[model samples]
Target: MTSTLASPDLRRRLEGIQLPDPLGFGTLMAPVMAIAHYRDGAWEDVRLDALDPLSLAPHTQALHYGQAIFEGMKAYRNLGTDLPGTALLFRPHEHARRFNRSATRLGMPELDEDVYVATLERLVSTLDALVPERQGQSLYLRPTMFGATAHLSVVPSTEYCFVVLATPSDAFFTAPISAWIERRFSRAGPGGTGNVKAAGNYAASFAAAAPLAKLGFQQLLWLDAVHHTHIEEFTAMNVFVRRGDTILTPPLSDTILAGITRDSLLRLAGSLGLSMVEKPVDVAELVDAIASGEDVEVFGCGTGAVVAPVELIGDETGLRLPLPPFPVATRLRRHMLDLQHGVLPAPAGWQRPVPTR
Candidate 1:
């Protein structure tokens, strides 16, 4: 087992910190973090150190030009076992692949896949004691990379820093979420950074999400930037709709993020004997279907909220579409959670056990 480079004080900090009564999503962070630096056209040593503030120059290229990218994943403590300090990671390699894709899209250097996986394993293993044991809780991992060099020119930085931070978190959304269909401010355009997990993509969403939050909506259901009639996805999740035996989700494009949980659900839908299709979902058509009782279920999928049912979707004109009982979404969420928590046997290569040092 590889040893972590965390200082003794860092270890003490981990042992002393107590999680909050309700571990809200991304609110409390673990004591240690993994960091790797890239300089002179090469990657450097990856270290596990105490979680501390980062010191960056004021004119950091990432701050100015937006060369930052990130990924969200989770590590779950195994279920039905009294084993001390053991956990499982679901589709970590898939996340690594997506991470590299995000890096490439932003003209940034990609972390080696082996290094990415090993760093994640080392971080999870080192913090095994902090991995939440509850059903809806897990160690949420955020892997972020940013251009570090300070410059005023509009160009990629020569140096970069990649870091992985962990937080013991509950479900991102505890209840069914209400979405405000965004028509005026589009999340991403046809040939933009919509496909990548770029930091700016989320920063742009604040414009639409702030007003919706004031109106009691939980999230922004983004529409296509081109026509504003097609459903792209939510601010942080992939959207899906169910009509009877068929499961429908928007087709993958350069404008929509390819979500790992979304892919897993689509594959699991086949096992559950539900037909799955990926096509352009028109907002008007979906609204009409819901009003006519043709579409019975709507949901969103992502790493944070494995599967979250959408209870209602409202537009700017005060017209709202309410979905019926979320039978399909609920079933899929249960099955996916079962597989994640080791209650059910995981499909081949889906779950990877975290090794304890």
Candidate 2:
């Protein structure tokens, strides 16, 4: 893979930056970023430059019309480490596939996967030391493409800019969480951008979720945007439930974000001797299962945090489902993290090591 832009100024900027001791998730930014612009019917040369505020025109289309998509991934320094620590990526290809899908859904051009992957490799290799080395620590990579042209009408912008930035941080969550089942606001409607990781989808959710934090709910369980009957996802993560040996998760409906971690979990379930089901799991059914003591565990999965077990599910009716005594979520989380950190034997081609030093 060849990078089009690499400068002494950018290298000096990277060397001059100082990161904190315990980097929090998405809090600390790497000093440099990779950017590429799409205009005039072609992708321009990829540029490596210092991380700085972007300059936008007075009427940028993305700012007004909300034409953008992004992807989140983690690169760990877990591979090739011998003494105590080794890092691994959970399922990066999954993110790549979804990222392109998001672009397609929003009327944006699909970035060539070869170019995308090569660009990712180049950036990861360049920021190798910034890859967190501790257990559960990683460099959170955010790749985003947004409309760059100015347009008053609702048409897609002809120009776009894609950039990749990294955030070095420890585990996103060291504890379980209590979530609320949002019965009022729907994250996506039928024939909407629910399945895609679009910027507007998240902006639409903030109106409903921001208020819930005051009520003490860590997150909201978004429903199917049409009828608001089924469980869709929580913020950007997918939902799952476990009953005995059978693992059940919401099906990949058009309104659901197909998570890489979700796919990895389903694949790993088989080898772990667990039965898996992918279908439209009703939120009411889940609440009933918890009330009747059938649902053993509940969790959410995404690139940020592989598995976050749900301790409570609060509803508008004052109902809360307490998670039953079972470490299925914990077990699965450990396995996934282990596979990512190289603590356990990795699946062939699941991880790619960074050659630094």
Question: TM-score of every model?
Answer: 0.96, 0.93
lDDT of 2 by residue, 79-111 (tens): 444433333555666677889999988888877
lDDT, candidate 1, 1-357, per-residue tens: 222456666677777667786999888899899998899999988899878999999999998899999999999988944343378889988999999999999999988887888889989988887889888799999999999998988988899999999999998887899988898998888779999899999999987787876777898888888889889899999999887777789999988999999899888876788898998888888888888987478899999998999998898898877788898888888888878887778778888888787
Q: Find the number of clashing residue pairs for candidate 2.
A: 4
Off by over 4 Å in 2: 16-18, 79-90
**lDDT for model 2:** 0.80
Best by TM-score: 1
Go through the candidates in order and give each one's C-alpha lDDT.
Answer: 0.87, 0.80
Candidate 1 minimal-lDDT segment of 10 residues = 1-10
Clash pairs for candidate 2: 77-87, 78-86, 78-87, 79-87
